[model samples]
Target chain A: MFRTISNPWISLASRLILAAVFIYASIDKIAHPDLFAEVVHNYRILPIATENLFAMALPWIELGTGVLLLLGLLTRSAALLSAFMLIVFIAAIGAGLWRGIDITCGCFTVSSEGRQLGWLTLLEDVALLLPSFQLLLTAHPGISLDRRYLPASPLSAEPR
Target chain B: MKDWVAAHRGKATIAGAVLIVCVFGSIGLLRNAVAEHPLAWVAKPPVLVKYDRAVRPSPDALQTVTLEDAAGMAFDAGALFVDARTAEEYAAGHIQGAVNLPTNHYDDELPAVAARLEGMTLIVYCDGGACEASLQVARRLLKSGYAPVVVFTGGWPEWQGAGYPTEAGGTPSP
Candidate 1:
């Protein structure tokens, strides 16, 4: 399974799906940063001083990474970033559940209407996170903008 | 592992962080530079709220009411009690004179409450201290011109726990 995922075609498919999910998740947060910030506050994880900064800045980071990943520009770095974020999200969700903080998941929206954190949300993040982590570890150089524009560095060159 | 770091992780991590900062930070700063106020990331809540006449009252604006206080105010026509739990939760049971204005659905419910609730001391509450719906709803109400509004931090559970006045179903008592 691990070797199969590292195959270029499989990697490309996984990349596209993961990029789409991130891009989709980012739009609501970017559009409603204030609400998103409020949702972050509800989690009671970050201190009050940092909530606004994280909410305002994170969507853009997600958006940038998603776009780059979609274009296969800076593929490995984007994969690493997205994987790191997923891990953080997993931790946040787990913390909220452990502490029994009943708040909106804020995974997809700024609204607390119906999206509360639970075991299912945790499972979903883990499922999604695996591909991102796999992409980073495998680091496949496929049909990518990074491949097209920037060729191999001397470090990546094969020794005879 | 060491070889991979020398090849990949070393430059990539720095590049990613720098890229996010330079791009997003500039956009957020630019938006704040032109808008009515700095956007959330740059705007300190205290600074923004320092001298502004409150649109809604904070919990600190007045003492949080106890079951006794709420019971006494329940009969007053001018005392506005707001339940900040969900409609379903409110429907299940709430303080007798309180109306639902859940944080989740505040935008939908605000106009009606705002128009009719002027001159009333709005007392917002939810499912007790662990619930933030009340706090969020209270802030929105303040922003929407609900003055003298204060939170009852001990919300429904506290009121119910004390066997204070409560009624079930969606409608508020007249």
Candidate 2:
């Protein structure tokens, strides 16, 4: 499982998949900042004032990292950030559940994904995390812009 | 954990952290420049109860009213129980004698639910556990002239899960 998935082609596929997800997830949020802000407020996690800020910014962060991952440029950075973000997402949802705060918006996602316990449990969280962790760990993910632009060295090139 | 971090260790992890900070930080800066707003870590809305009731929030009914409190007032003719879940969720099952008035549909539900709740302590609730509908509905009720409403934040699922009386079907039985 590990070797098959870690191959350049598989790693590239994983990176693109994670990228597409983050990109797709961020679109509606960026378009509807107000609704997103209200959703954030509903979690009751952040102060009333900061809700708008997160609403304003999180989608962009997702978009930026997602684009980088999709292009196989900054693959490691993008995937690492993606993994960290998922960890935060899981924690936020978990904390909301623990505190009994009612994080749902309507169907799925608190901030764009996995707002409900059922949604989180039904692979939304883990499915997203798997590729990101793969991207973070796999060296020299293929079809990478980094490989082209940064030139050869184990640090920036094919593994020795 | 250490092993995992060590495997990914290199400039990539450092760069990722920096990029994330820079991007998120830019958001913060832009927000401050274009729009200024207060930032609180998290804010808890108060649970408002009627004046005749003890001014002190019953330990039972802070941001969330306990299941026991919900049951204690379940059948009180004078206490209005409002379910903030979707009509479908209410139909699936809910606290017996609780009226469906989902927060999202507040405007549509207000006139009728409000009329029924006149002069009574309103208990706003939903399916519970991070379900904001209860809080949102409760606040809306407060905004819509219902004062001192209690958020049964423990909500419908909790009430039902505890083996309390429940009712189901298209029409809520309040």
Candidate 3:
């Protein structure tokens, strides 16, 4: 069971899935930074001073992570970041729910009236964390740029 | 020594993630700086309120209202709520006591409703967040001789989200 769970194919699949999710999530946000800023503010989690900075930077980070995972370059690193982001998302959604903040999830869409922030949104983030953890744990760069470019890297050095 | 490797097993990966964040974050900031309209460093609430000077007959003639002010005025007998959303939306829900005055139907409805609006403060609103129907209606009201017209920029979403007074599926309460 452990070997199957840690299989190279499984790791590759996880990386690709997370990559698509991140890339799709980043597009609207990058195009509409001002609206995205408003969405981030609606969460009311971050300090007001930091909201715009966070809104501007986060989508790009997701885009970068997505591209890296898509290419399977720095697979472990991208996976780690993906997991970290999911944790933050889960927490933010949880906080929003706790405070009864009736807001759109601002997950895939930064639109004002998109998906409402709720337990289902929290669950979706939590489920994405599974694939992120799989990629992080497996670190199996199957047919990947990481395998070709970082041959001597510690993660790639493990016996197949 | 072996324990240290275990402790810092993914240190390089962590560093790589940090580097990716810094690199991409810098790119985002740079792109934002050079963009035509740079995003504000501090995000304000999603209220894009601009009281058009050209449309205003007088400086104090047109005004904007926050949710708190609108809420306070809701109870005032002299203040009347006018919802500028479509009639269907108005039927779905609206601020309690607000009259349905759909922007599209303004010409047909205004003549009938204008006389009833005399000697009262008009608090106009729509669906909010970039929906300018309220502004359009408010401007028309100003032209029609309604004084002290206040546009609730936050509008219905903000009011509904805040759990303020609202009603549905009826002609607006008197």
Top candidate when judged by DockQ against the true structure: 3
Put down candidate 2 lDDT per residue, B1-174, tens digits, no spaces: 435444655764666567775876576446545543433333345444433365645532334467777677766767778888878788898777778887655676777766677888778887676666777677667657675577776676677778887778877664
Deviating ranges (above 4 Å) for candidate 2: A1-7, A27-59, A90-108, A111-115, A118-124, A152-160, B1-9, B28-81, B92-99, B104-123, B127-132, B141-167, B172-174
Task: Write down the worst ten-residue block by lDDT for model 1 chain A.
Answer: A151-160
Instruction: Score chain B of each candidate by TM-score.
Output: 0.73, 0.65, 0.65
State the fraction of real interface contacts model 2 keeps.
Answer: 0.20
Residue pairs with backbone overlap in model 2: A100-B130, A101-B130, A102-B130, A102-B131, A103-B130, A109-A113, A109-A114, A109-A115, A110-A115
The B-chain TM-score of model 2 reads: 0.65
DockQ of 2: 0.26
Clash count list over all predictions: 2, 9, 0
What is the lDDT of every predicted structure here?
0.72, 0.67, 0.80
Task: Report the C-alpha lDDT of model 1 over A30-55, residue by residue, as the tens digit.
Answer: 77777788788777788787887777
CA shift of B131, model 2, Å: 6.9
What ranges in model 1 sit over 4 Å off? A1-3, A153-160, B1-10, B25-29, B32-63
**Which lDDT value does model 1 have at A16?**
88
- State the lDDT at B1 in candidate 2: 47
For all the predictions, what are the DockQ values? 0.41, 0.26, 0.50
TM value for model 2 = 0.60
Using lDDT as the measure, name the better of candidate 2 and candidate 3. Answer: 3
